[model samples]
Target chain A: MGLDQPLEGALAPPMRNGELAFEEPWQGRVFGMAKALCDAGCFEWAEFQAQLVETIREWERTPEGEYASAPAEQETYYNHFLAALERLLEAKQLVAGGAVEARSEAFAARPHGHDH
Target chain B: MSELKPQAIRAEALESLLIEQNHLTAEAVDEVIIRYNERVGPMNGARVVAKAWADPDYKACLLEDGTKAIEEFEFEGGEIDKLVVVENTATVHNVVVCTLCSCYPWGLLGLPPRWYKDPAYRSRIVREPRAVLAEFGVVLDDDVEVKVWDSSAEVRYMVLPMRPDAAAAMDERAVLELITRDAMIGVAR
Candidate 1:
């Protein structure tokens, strides 16, 4: 049978007139982070790719907890991208271990409606 | 505004962390984003498609070695090292997806469409191509064999769509305008 309904795991990316478009400021920011880091020679593009592939595989292997519940909002593709980027940075010693986690906590603790 | 999602928070955290450590500057990151959004994009792919339609020898070269032929454009970006150009024929149709992640020919087509990166598209396109293509508004005959190319880090793929008969009298410039990014991706014909 044709699977005509919306699939559970993946959400279509944000687009405009069939073109790649970012819906959120962070989506673009993370995308640029990965590309900029590669351009800066922190690691080869292939290295980042390896991390990304592994990250995605890990997600696929996951038993569909958070991803299954809120596929569109949680555990999105960019989440995998961020995970891969974080892993790469830590591996390359570009960022101190746990610094991202620490900083993320700080950002999360920011006042409600904080713009920056 | 709504409270930032954890993913967004993490993205910001990573950016600030990298900047604070001097590993990357916010300006550098912004510049890369701007370049992808403004400078590099599908026009390069359209030029390649148009040239293949206009020149037989160039078409042969493109079909033979996509990587080298695309290099003639001297485009800037990643994901063009080992490109394999697939031609759509009367009976064979080609569509691209990356089941693992979003592995696209960024140098040629720029950033992949969000739907291209969507997990549903990646998984469903391979298994039920005709149904998925129908959703994209591309309806193929029952006899047409649908072939899905799953892009990888090692090799990238771009479909060489057949020039529509309507463009038979059009010049290469006009034909180039007819080529859309989705056509090159084989989502639209």
Candidate 2:
């Protein structure tokens, strides 16, 4: 399948000269990571899209007013992206279940930039 | 070492697993990070804006064909399927958002600001752009028409911010410095 077909209606209609926008460094990181994973054959693009569709559906079920009341830090779409990715990786056994959660805790405890 | 957020940690772990499974290499992971940081950014867009400001022909070309004009800079990524450059004029202002999902021009403007992808922004910007702009401390005159562009995965939009008066005396490099990602996104002037 082509890249455009699966993405159709998955997002809003394209505006002229529009590009992918990232709000934070991690947003781009997550995007790049997902692309890298897809390139590596961990899962097909369609599989990830399925997970994403599921994630977005769950998010949409929340009452409209709930978003206004939610904390400022909780509004990242990439967070959902990560959640969906985690689900896929676990289902595929590409990474052991809970491995990411544990790694998250470890990094949070030490909190050091791992660049390079 | 700087502090690593939980998201960063998760990403690191994922990369490691990919490497361990022979799916990717450490070098490849590093290259991705570097690409996001250096290869793509607002600076690239700023240069295009600066060039447009300096040359009317270039501006016409940019407004006519954003994708081809941007390629003149020799940016490596081929992610943008189509690009549309909107001009912010005296009577018209343009702001962009993706209500369904966060689709933006990563190749030109780099990652969007946190607020750009916020649910509040996605839902509110289209309905009341002037009010949204005000909240961002950009209170335009009432006479100006605000055009809200909805971006998708196929086509991305960038605002060609009006060149500031100060830019008239400055070189292209100087003018480039004055262009912020938010300005290009039409959240700020």
Candidate 3:
């Protein structure tokens, strides 16, 4: 949402700092999904403080972006973030508190997640 | 402070010393980073497509809301304010081109791959989806209507190619093997 931040390279320093501190490297809308899901109550990522770090490390290993750093803990957390969410979804059976249900209706509430 | 500037000068001198010893090239260094981003950029989104195809509910959510659809994955650093995932279904097909400027979905997608960033590809794709795709070796049925999305302003799109029947039993990772970045932009079949 904010265009004020500088683009990567010859500009800003590395965005992730081994989990000590970091910036949101995503385009504005990528965040909207989590926000929308959060608003709907699919699950809040309050515990996601460390989750992002893991995800970053995962990105480093695959045929993805090869950062100068060995592998960031921040990325590793991020790499694991989805698994964490899925775990929560399975254990909680909750989507945005009950918002997951509404999101299920995102196009049309699946009355029960079944074909209409 | 003047003292601070002196300290900064010393730091630069020290950095230069390290650079000389390590055989580092600053200008070339940036080029390499950009090159890497180009190679792996759209592959991330390619994986997303595989996931959606394997799961029905995820596909519905993606069509309903692409931005949210991405959060369902582990990919990070997405620079998205808005996202529109276009599905290339049978009756209708979608091709993504950044006509005004290369506005890409960098989150689920790592970065804009090289060809998409090409001037020739950009200028021509919007004016001619069918023709351009043909160049990239992707031929579509003339009966299938092609919709070219000139991604500019407040919107960005990535194509969720209709899963090829050949990959029905494949897992998500296996399916990703079949999707090339060009397919995401509607250049390849």
Q: lDDT tens string, model 3, A1-116?
A: 12111122232322221221212222211222233344444455443322443443454466743543322233333224433443354345432243332332332311322322
Q: Score the docking of each candidate (DockQ).
A: 0.31, 0.21, 0.02
Off by over 4 Å in 1: A1-20, A65-75, A112-116, B171-173
The digit string of per-residue lDDT tens for model 1 on A22-107 reads 76767777888899888888889999899988987887778862254312432377778889999999999888898888877976
The lDDT of model 3 is 0.53
Q: How close is candidate 1 to the true structure, as a TM-score?
A: 0.88
lDDT for each candidate structure: 0.80, 0.72, 0.53
- Candidate 2: interface RMSD equals 8.6
Candidate 1's residue-wise lDDT over B116-178, tens digit each? 877778788988999999999999999999999999998999999997887779977788889
Candidate with better DockQ, 1 vs 3: 1
Interface RMSD of each: 10.3, 8.6, 23.6
Q: Number of clashing residue pairs in every model?
A: 2, 18, 40
In candidate 3, stretches whose alpha carbon ends up further than 4 angstroms from where it belongs are: A1-116, B1-40
- Off-target runs (Cα >4 Å) in candidate 2 are A1-29, A38-54, A63-71, A74-76, A87-116, B1-13
The order of the candidates by DockQ, greatest first, is 1, 2, 3
Two-way DockQ contest, 2 vs 3, winner: 2
lDDT of 3 by residue, B57-92 (tens): 998988889877787575654446578888888788
